[model samples]
Target: MSDVVPVKLRPEILAQRAYKQGQPAPANSFKLSSNELPFAPLDSVVAAATGATEFNRYPDAAATKLRQALAEHYGLTAEQVLVGAGSVSLLYQAVLAAAGAGDEVMYPWRSFEAYPGMVTVAGASSVQVPLDRDSRVDLDAMLDAITDRTRLIIVCSPNNPTGTYTRQDEFERFLERVPSDLLVIADEAYIEFVTDTEALNATRLLADYPNLVIARTLSKAYGLAGLRVGYLLGNPRVLNAFNTTAIPFLVSAQAQAAALAVMQEADSVRARVNEITMRRDEVRRALIDQGWPIPESQANFVWLPCGELAERVDEILRQGGIVARTFPGDGIRVSIGEEASTSPLLAACARALERYPYLRREEAEAE
Candidate 1:
C-alpha cells in the first residue's frame, strides 16, 4: 500500500458545515418544520406530474414552456427567466456564478443557515451581518460590511427563522446605496405567505437593477415541495451566468409540467395562502397571549425567540406528535401549514411553558 492516501478534495469542503434539513416524523405526525404549504397540489398539477412523458428522453434544457408560463405570470420575458431543481439549487448556482476565492458574500446571520454553507462551498468568504433587535436584517451593518472584495449580497425577504421582512422604502434605499457592480440576490421563497401590502416586490426592482436576481420556489405556497421546482428572474447577462454554473438536466420534466400547471391556477394557490395566513395569525396571537416571545411573521411560519427553550419546546411538540424545526442556540421555527391546527400548536406552547416556567418568567422580566 502507498504511504500517502489517495484523496483529492478542497480544504474548504472539509471545513464546510452540512445543511440541516427539517426532520420527517412518522406517518400521521404533524410535520411543521420545513414550511411546506398546507394544501396538496391542484388536480391539474397532479395530472401533469402523473402523465409526464419523455422519461426516456432528457428534459428540456431551457425549460422553455415553464419559463414562458413563469414569465407571463410575473410580467417578464422568457429570456429573463431560468428554472432549476429548486430554489436552493438556484441559490447554489447563483453563489457560484457571483463569488469565488478571495471574494466575500454578505447575508444576514441566522436568516438562512444555508447561506454560509453555500458561500464556503463556492470557495468564497461569508460576511454574516447581524440582524436588528426585531430580527430583521440590519441594513446599516450590511452596508458597512461591503468591501471591494464583496461580489454578492443575498437578502431573504420575510426572512427564514425570523419571519420578518424589509419594508419597501427601506429596500429601495438599500438598493440605492449598494454598488451597482455587485449581484444582489432576493430570495423570496416564502413570498406567497406575505400579506403585507407595503412589502417590497423584488421582481419589480429587477428592471431598475440590472444586477438584481429574484429566486422563487414552488415548494412553498404551491404545495410542490416534493416536486422541487424553482426559478430565477434577472437580467439576461446575470441569468446567462447562472445557466453556465447550473447542472444540466437539473429540473425534471414532471416538475416542470407541475410548476406550469400550478402557475396557471393562481387563484387556487391564493386561496390556500389565505387559509395559512389565518392559521399563522391565530398561532402568533396564542403564543403572545401565553407570554412567549413571538415576532410578527410575514412568512408561513412563526419564530419563537425562546433561545435554550427551543430544544425543550421542540421536544414537547415532538412528544405531542408534532415535529418542529429547532436551531439549537437560536430558537424554534414552526411552519403554518393548512393542517396545522391552532389548538395543537397552542397546546404545545402551553405545555412547553408549563415545563419551563423560567422561560415565561424571563420574558416577563425583560418586558
Candidate 2:
C-alpha cells in the first residue's frame, strides 16, 4: 500500500486525506467518541433487520416505502421525502447537485469536518464562517459572506463538536437576508436530542422557504447507527434535482426495514432522547461548576474547549475508561452514554482541570 499509483487521480483528493473516525476504546472502556447511542438494538429493530432475507436482489433504488413512512410521520407528501444511505450520503448528493467549480458553498467552520472534503469533491469552494465564543453559528458574519457565487449554505443546528444551537427567530431573520434562489440546507442530524423549544427545527419553516431542505438521520435517535439510513424533506421540485445525483441502491433493504419499524416506537425514542438530553445538561453544568469553562450543550454531548491540551485531555479520559472525540488543538466532545460512564468521565475532567489550572480560567482571563 504505497503512494505509487498505476493511474492518475484527482490531485485535490490526493492532497486531502480520507475521513478520520474517532478513536476506539479498549475492552473495559466506554466508547463515547462517536455520538452513537449507548443502548443496545431494540428487539423490534433487530427483528426487522434480520427479517430481510432477500439480500440477493437489489434494494429499492428510490427507497419508496421508507420515504413514504417518513413523509407521513412529518405530515408531508411522499414526494417531499428522499431517503439515502445516511444523511451524510444525502449531503454529498445535495452538494453535487448544487455547486461545481468556481461556485461557493457556505457553512460554519468546526461544524461537520466532512463538509470541506465533500465540497472539494464537487469541484466547489468552501466559505467557512467562524463560530462565536460560545461556539454558536455567527449568523451575521455568515450573512455578510454571501455573494452571487454562493449556491448552497448548510446550517447545522445544535452544531457538531460544539453542541450550540441556532435559535428559531434568529435563523428566520437570517433566512430572510439570504437570496431567495440559493439553496439552504438545514442539517439536523441530532434534532431528536434537542430539548430547547427555541432551537431551529427547519422542517417547520420548509413551506415558507422554497429554498430550504432539511436533512435528518435515524442513526442517532433511533439507535440505528449501523443501518446507515437518513432522509431529506423539501419542495419536490428541488429534491427531484438532488435525486438525480444519488448513488443507486445505496440504502440496503434491512436499513429501510429498521427505519420503518423504529418509526412506530415514537414514545420509546422520546424517552431515550430525553435521558441523553438530561445527561448532557448535567455534564455541562458539572463541568461549569468545576470551573472548566464548558459551553451549554443542547445535544447529546458536551464540549471541553481544551485548546492545545485536547490530545492530552483525550489521553486522560481514555485512561479513565472514557474515550472521547478529540480535535487536536481544539477541544474534546464526549457523547452522553450509559449511566455508568458518567462518573468516570466527570472524574477524568475534574482531574484534567486540576492538572491544567490555566484551562479553568475565564475566557477573557485565559487569553
TM-score of each: 0.95, 0.98
Deviation (Å) of 205 in candidate 2: 0.7
**Which ten-residue region of model 2 has the weakest summed lDDT?**
357-366
lDDT of each prediction vs. the true structure? 0.87, 0.90
Residue-level lDDT tens digits of model 1 in 238-258: 899889998899889999888
Candidate 1 segments exceeding 4 Å error: 1-6, 361-367
Best by TM-score: 2
List of clashing residue pairs for candidate 1 = 38-338
RMSD of 1: 2.5
Q: Give candidate 2's error at residue 183 in angstroms.
A: 0.5
Judging by lDDT against the true structure, name the best candidate.
2
